[model samples]
Target: MMKALLATVLAVTPVATVTRLSLPPPTGPAKVGVVTAHLVDRSRPDPWVATERFRELMVSVWYPARSVRGHQRADWVTPGVAARINTPDSGFTLPVTHGHLNAPAAAGKHPVILWSPGFGMERTSGTALAEDLASHGYVVVTVDHTHDAQFVEFPDGRIATNAIPPVATPAEEEQLIGKALDVRVTDTRFVLDRLRTMPLARHMDLSRVGMFGHSMGGAAAAGTMLADRRIRAGLNLDGSFAGPVLEAGLDRPFLLLGSESHDGEQDETWTRMWDNLRGKRYRMELDGSAHLSFSDFQVLLPQLGLPPDQVEPAVGTIDGPRSVAIQRAYVRAFFDRHLRHRDGRLLDRPSPRYPEIRFP
Candidate 1:
């Protein structure tokens, strides 16, 4: 994760003038529809906020929609969440998304892909990927882990910031992150349970479930797969596994797509997990990408006028559109192959179109 880089950049960079931005349109055929839900897991107490008796979550479900003609498009982040993260003077308005709000789901059952964002990042940070997957006939659930997310805006107007206990030492830091990952795994399972009861549930094929995440979320994806058999395949974008996931290993289909700095040879955790994999697995490195390149930051940062020096270190040297395209292709290819039983030869070998992708 680019945690250090983000902190450094945020601390030193001067706030710019406010400019409105829009997410790149999804490349798939279907128009995307999104709905937000407030889910509560009464079975468990929140690990981060002990004062709370139940674990509450805000989740957005993106799926193939009938049309985007009259429905209102969704905001990238709720005004409250955006205000909490960005200063008023810092020309950082949340981007407008391509998804229509509460549109009717398209007919027929579709595979499901659960998404989690980086630590202290909002679930909407994965909106680009979710929209892309929804356009391609998959129902993607993006969860905002209350307290862990930078800010979760509930329907009732309550906003929750990350409440994980602070650590004074590196060991305590690891422990805190480990506990956060555990909470994320539990959150994902609860979201899955709630999805089965939704009106849109009839259009979702839960049996073909998959999960993918960026940074800490990616770590959670691997951990969730190990903990839940419902996740038939998992993808990790620039994240290293921890705790039981790193120790117990995984036997299901998993994909490790990372930035250049932490490829298979560079990261021992990746090597260990790769070797322990018992089912179909693939590992790839995007040559020009950095940790945040797999995130919406790849596009958002540049639009905000962050210089190449600052953006490139955290994201990558690749053009934002190209980065998004490459990620969308590879991610969908993996899911299409494993969950839908389609031929994903794209995963079998490197493609000339994306010379930036390296397989080891």
Candidate 2:
């Protein structure tokens, strides 16, 4: 029943990437928790324009907390967005919050999920999905890929503006893809390792883990599954396949949830990845959905007074309620099935209840 209450109001896009200024106020008996760490891309160099000290990131881990009532919730973003409009290279500062006010803190080990946002998108782009997962008792670790994301905010007043990587040229796209695979997989693997040692995160259930992403983030999800055997399964939300993932020929349980543009015969990457799945594999397409459909922006656009055409027409096909509900159901089902080893009809087959979801 817990969902992103203010999801409709949080808008993030290619044009305007303002971040959360404060954590969502708590609610219910369930509490919330969050932590962030900087990750070096290793593959890219900071552009000349980037501040030398602002090259690193701060990635947050959100979960249901136990006793967040007394603790102060972090801001959703830094306070400078309004005043720093002239700073073209600034990042969004986010607050680390416990669950809604009066919400109960989660106890014991729960499932764990590693999250990746789309290309050129910060980890917060998938906040709606991430927060919902956290509310459902998953330790959601959202990775902030340095030099790739716009910016990542830290607990302190400091912010890390995205260090521009080597300019991505047409000729370098393939190399960038390869580098992305390395960056995503290594960063996730390190976090999993570090989580075991984190004094604060000692309660996590490391064995129960899954990976997911949107757009290029989706591709990174598949890449993580291939690179790490510790991951039980993976899910991709409308990301194309390339890089070493296809070359390796994936052999684990994976899901490809795509948009309308990516479901056709011309988009062979989706089909090729589908063909290469050696374990359980499923594909679903949302009618009229676009590349950005998987992100929360779909719901935030109308609330921001944006025109209908501002979002891809295909993305508009997915109404907010149905879209968010479907995302919650399927994502929870995927992680629930593999991480918890539970049986769920949501992942069993195409259902009449979710008429909007077309399984191919």
Candidate 3:
């Protein structure tokens, strides 16, 4: 999301213009810990390649940490991944993530939550939400689909970048994006199957799993729920559904948290999904938010010193910090209600604490 802005500004904005920006701190009290695994699925071949017979993925697990001291802080993205988005020549740096490197997982099991980022967007883009969920005693995992993420750096020092091409027509757009969603559904399910084998398995209660994503990833969240029964609840952040997920609505709880312009009147996919839905649901719109506001760009992009005209279109007119708070609170509420069996008041109606949310 900040790619074009960084390229434009770095050209005329001068060198050594670095601002170390931080993701908003989680509201929960527990300290966060994170560890990553390089997972390979021998059952599926590389979706975007022919030479490879196995699909490879990079997965990060975040959980409540027993102790974060004496460990190095994790970078938002790996150095190799950062070089693709934030140019090294500009001397700019992303903030260290709230998670400490491979800190010990807190005692006892916690409900698991899986995150899928927007299409062609890296898994790191959802760090704010993932970290926040982890702090609240949830074992949250984020996945980077090789060849679909901005870039994925394997343990072997191999970097796989996005290879999806541009399309000209809506038909072509649907065909390409539909294919991507199919791959993401398998990716989501594959990650869930492998979660129990990770070191954090003792802290992960996969029985109470919930899933969510931004943009196309959000749509895939629903698709995966349909394909896999293990996913008990799902939510979509400012995204429209594709494929059978659009028509074959879920019986399990599903929440739609969308931006100002993403309504049933504007997008038929949402309308169909809402009408087809048989379980608990809420179609929420953040008044001042744009599509990207639902992602980390809501807070991260403003620090880049882009032109105001450029910034507004990306994250929207809402206060960046305010948007982040609203998203973090409501998202947690929905998951808490569905995954943990807690009664959620935030999803019941528009609260004064967050006036920007509307039920449509």
Q: What does candidate 3's lDDT look like per residue over 223-304, in tens digits?
A: 9999999999999998888889777899999999999999978888999999998899888999988878987878877776
Stronger candidate by TM-score (1 vs 2):
1
After superposition on all C-alphas, the RMSD of every candidate to the true structure, in Å, is: 1.8, 6.3, 2.1
lDDT of 2 by residue, 162-251 (tens): 443564587786676677667667777766776776544665788888889987788888888787888888999988887767867677
lDDT of 1 at 122: 79
In model 2, how large is the Cα lDDT of residue 69?
Answer: 58
| lDDT (CA) per prediction | 0.86, 0.67, 0.86
Clash pairs (backbone) in predicted model 3:
none
RMSD of 3: 2.1
Deviation in Å, model 3, residue 285 alpha carbon: 0.6
For each of the candidates, give the backbone clash count: 3, 32, 0
Over 4 Å off, model 2:
1-29, 38-55, 72-74, 80-105, 164-169, 264-266
- The candidate with the higher lDDT, 1 or 3, is 1
Q: Can you write out model 1's per-residue Cα lDDT over 225-328, one digit (the tens) per residue?
A: 98899999999999887878786888899999999888656678898888888889999998888888888888877776766787788778888888899999
